[model samples]
Target: MSSHSTGTGKHHPVPKRYALLFACCLLLAIALLADFLWASSSNLSSSSHSSLNLSLDSSNEVVAVSVSTPPQPRSIKKKKEPKAVNRELMYLNATYADIPAPHWDWEEMPEAPVPRLDGFAIQLQNLFYVFAGYGSIDHVHSHVDIFNFTSNTWVGRFDMPKEMANSHLGMATDGRYIYAISGQYGPQCRKPTNRNFVLDTKTKQWSELPSLPVPRYAPATQLWRGRLHVMGGSKEDRHEPGLEHWSLAVKNGKALEAEWRVEVPISRGGPHRACIVANDKLLVIGGQEGDFMAKPGSPIFKCSRRHEVVYTDVYMLDDGNQWKQLPPMPKPNSHIESAWVIVNNSIIIVGGTTEKHPITKKMILVGEVFRFNLDNLEWSVIGRMPFRMKTTLVGFWDGWLYFTSGQRDRGPSDPSPKRVVGSTWRTKLHL
Candidate 1:
């Protein structure tokens, strides 16, 4: 009673809500302490794993670790194309420094003894035997003009046999004898003759040989191993060209035996063949083909420049007696009657003709020059002539290429004034 009166009596019991709150607070403090201890253990474990990775890498081991990073986009690559080339510029710069162009020193040879066109020329020793061709507008010549390079003059002029006045004849020489085969004769040139003539150049004598099986104008004739091989020409007219190959046996290496037979029929046969024999191969170059010539009943006798397809097609006689085609000539040189010669085993082609206009069939003379090398099988334009020329006969002697007389602008039709030249142009071919 005394203690209660002097101080406050003993406290009463707590409320139920307050007692529940105190119990919850005590449980939360215990949970927080446990979480801190768990965090420390996880940190120590992570440091130990990183140390293990470093030790493995130093010991020359491979350790792959996967990371959860967002995937990155991949990059693509592209290809580049080649650039275009200029062909014309390439051609102009085709000249080589090592193989400098041929030192072309041209000189005018003595004027030919006679002016003619569509004739054939052969070189024997130092003499040139120019056979008969069209001498005048109305007639063909039978006169043989001999050009003596030794004497530097036309030493002699002889007449062919009265029956042998022919033009557009196929001629070949065997060093001593000249074999004159079929040709177009008479004033009208309508008469295609099969008369074969032989001339002993040494004896200055002429004799008849076995006639050709069929008469043709400008037959592709050449002497192969002493046998006369005649290929293609027009049978009736220049328009009707055939593909018959005829050969005759040479008796005593001079006279032609009577036997005449067809060797082979090849479609490569054409007119105005600039034929040459090199490396045991007979090469036939530009000529005329197809039925573009004046018709049989037409007013003209010879083929005119109308709808004619010039033969740029080349043919070579193989060892097996077959004709095989070679690479074609360049364009704009489709007309035949080009001057050609084999210089240093290279076929050098000179002036020719081409169509003057697309609509008009008339032809214009060209002075383009090109070289074909069999070694490389390539064609290149080497040089050009000083003046336009067509139907000019070409021959090679020593180091000079001789271009004999030919017509300038004259064609089959006599509409233009005749301009035949007798000049002999000599070009020094650089080997």
Candidate 2:
């Protein structure tokens, strides 16, 4: 049936079921949107709370919030420090303005009985004893010549032991006794002997000591702490350098030990170097590595020249196993094993062989007197000698510096060769 009148335009009424369904759908949509908005707000609040930990009081008041930070990486670097300088070393500049220039009065004293090289001189009281050395015409002097300082004359002479090594002997003295160690037994460029002997200066008698395990040529020998210490020299071949060090205990001219005890090896080794005990320190200075050797199958002992390395390296041993390096010498010098004397706190080094001449390629003898100051560990050229020489025997007595018996250079300026002389000279030290 039609519910509208034809002429009047009246609208038709909605269905009750349809109206109820539309109202219910609108309410449901609103509730769903509200729930979605509440869920989004809760998620944002939870994310903000996770970063900070909040402490609340009992009244629900916020007190403090602790925020955490990411950790930083650590560095692994260190700062460097400077090295400390040793003031006692030799390279330091020394002041010597107050010191006077050495005049070297240059007086001629009584000459020795024989001209020799590579010999040993020991002063006991007022007497200066010249021991065995390489003598004239390829011969080795096996006798001891005593010089009386008071009389200024050669007082007496005595024959050494027949078995005693002549040249390149390592000698040391303890006031009354003179200890003679290993060296070349016969003469020129010969094999070294291990035979050792001790001479009583008071009784003038030679006593045999236990032989050294290894022989050395011109080794540095000294008496330290009741023991005889020997270091650095040539080996059996006479060309190779020996770095071995040995020591022996002794009391009253008698060996306390039957055999020599091995000690610390030297940093460098060769023959004709100077070894001295000063201020409780053992110092080795100015030596050469290689030396002249005898030619094989040469009946007359002809020496063959080899490349030699001369150095000025200075080493010191101050009561330890290690050897500390000190300042080197002013120049390269060798053949001065016995060409030194201790004057006060200074060591005076006399004539010796320096480096060969560059142009001439010949040996150059050292003429300047070198003074090694033990206090500051410095080296100074004190004065010049009348003549250049090597293997000189130096003695200091009564304020006089005496030198005798060495190989003198030929000609004043020429670096040709050397001649052995028994001439003696002295000068009054003004230092």
Candidate 3:
């Protein structure tokens, strides 16, 4: 029995080292198989999709695992939106007619002296009536020089009553009666008169009426709906405050008797402003404000002043007396004496003084023509006049725009102290 026990011990269950080696070899083979399968699945997933992933479970067994890659971001392009267009406003035609030839033709006043500067000219019954302006001696004339197109002569002269002898006033006619409103009494007078008067075309006599509520110099006068509308003149001086609009209350039967009615106050007031009645609307154009003094290079003997404020704004007065501001003028005029006429249903603003030199600060005379279209409310340059004109008295009749008694051809180096034009120029109307 001892010998059997010893032999069994010596052969110790097929050697422990060998049994341990066999177990390790089996584990290594299983690991190798698992690695081979994992690598194959990884390659297959990569070929089928964008990416592949692998993970181990709790039991440590070879398992076929799959994970989906998140979707890749995409690039997109955006579209731009369009802008809105204005639908209410209309535009005028870009083209304008050219100025005619022989722009200025001298009309023989034939009288002892020609009509002076800052005078007003109006036509009624084929006769041109010029009145109430300062003469060569700087004396305000209450005289009226009448030019008849029928006889082609200065036929008659009428003197305003002594009470109504005033210059720098507004004049308007209602076919039968010529109305004269507020103005300066004399050439050198700084005080403005509120006195109003009317002249009978048949009798050629002056009669006094109710005075203006706001006495002003160079106020605008117009006849609309048988009512005289007076507007926008200086109260104290050229830029004096308290300027306003007033209308003469016309009695249905009475011709001369009318009461002064207050209308609207002008926010910006100046002398020689342009007023025109068009399309039943009252349009007040460019105006001037500032003191007048001698120019830089004016002659020692002569005297003139530089314009300070040249207005570029335009306004229209409605029935309710509200001023509707319009688009400003492209080329502004310095002098309030901008001449205006209505032709072919459009308002034409003629020559006026320029503000000053950009460097030299001298005023200039320009003959630019601008047309305001009533239908479209747009402005266009209708070419320039043949000659420079400023502070001119203008009138429209018989299809012609007449420019008379204005300053022209003034330059910086040779500035004239008494720069006034006495010649009358006519241009045909072309829309």
Candidate 4:
């Protein structure tokens, strides 16, 4: 396939949207892959807002909620007759707070012999294997890091399958192996490729899998009723991103090939996103979706040519196709960050940056948090991010959340961005 260029490559110093994707993780797997057990806060300061306790029901159904008020932004207009966000929904409030800070991790990764970013991670039996993010767009990644929590350090270094390329994509783990799916090919291709392969944890072997319907970044995958649902991502023909839905069914360890079919119809989501699956539905939180075109039956990448602005809308799709509109976000964003985490049945959206306004002169960091309630289609604003997008990586464990990295605020790609008090922090979530 011939590669395409997105725009004039005009260096837009300011990002259009802020509140981006966080860890779109499942509760069972989060504890397995990321060793977020250690609560570190050597540089921790008290959060500005006092923790408020709201009793939650044990049935696992989401309680309708919304941030309701944003500290009276003496400037931003207050929402009119703010309706109390509903709770019975599944993706209502996609925001909640419970992450411990560990910005120091960003510092630790490089000081060692390895340098990687936008990598993919999977876990099995307290062991996590992260592979494939490169040091930068100008370079290529050729190594993998295996971290053992039981030992509290890097266990070993291994070579990834030569076919492995690109970070900023999707990976899913079955607790036995990891499937590295759709993402770009370094700086070579403008759109992501559907090339996918499986990583065997024991032998550390990579095996190829069937390709996806579309080639794009940030699409999420999940094991639902014995099938692999690959949904969400950004696609471009010549302009903007794409919003489309497709599914991959794998049964008894076999992926159905030549199966790039868009069966169920839907409104295009951002061509890229940090999606998670629950109860036969795919929940798409923050990320970017552009070119609001209506392509009821057209293929995803085929609809890529048209370009437009990005967005931050939380949508839902049951059966992996039909998309339903839900509550709008308090802010406007066409997210470019990775800030997604899944708890029980809820989706947590963490930090990223958004343009200060339409003029795009200044960039403001998004420290806010949002969660989605799938059942009632509501949104809840949790709180502010303790740090920046590039330097933050959040993982949830034992009802608590943890984060690592620098106080990475959004800024133009500079030779040396003002890296801040690198440290770790953790928070206790009131479920």
lDDT of 4: 0.52
RMSD of 3: 22.7
Worst 10 residues of 4 by lDDT: 89-98
Query: In candidate 3, what are the lDDT values of residues 97-200, reduced to their tens digit?
Result: 12232334334333324647677777786777778676653556778887765554667787777776456778777677777787776655445688877788
TM-score of each: 0.68, 0.75, 0.66, 0.59
Candidate 3 — which residues are off by over 4 angstroms? 1-115, 150-152, 251-259, 291-307, 334-338, 411-418
CA lDDT of every candidate: 0.67, 0.83, 0.65, 0.52
Q: Tens-digit lDDT track for model 1 on 259-321?
A: 687787766665676666778787777676643344367564654443555656778886837
What stretches of model 1 exceed 4 Å from their correct place?
1-105, 251-253, 290-306, 331-338, 409-418
> Model 2 shows how many backbone clashes?
0
Residue 37's C-alpha lDDT in candidate 1? 92
| Highest lDDT against the true fold, candidate | 2
In terms of TM-score, the best-performing candidate is 2
lDDT of 4 at 5: 57
Instruction: Give the per-residue lDDT of model 2 (tens digit) for 42-113.
Output: 766765554466777899998777674332234744446433322222121222011233646598888899
Cα lDDT for residue 411, candidate 1: 41
Enumerate residue pairs that collide in model 2: none
Q: Which consecutive 10 residues in model 2 have the weakest lDDT in total?
A: 89-98
lDDT of 2 at 297: 94
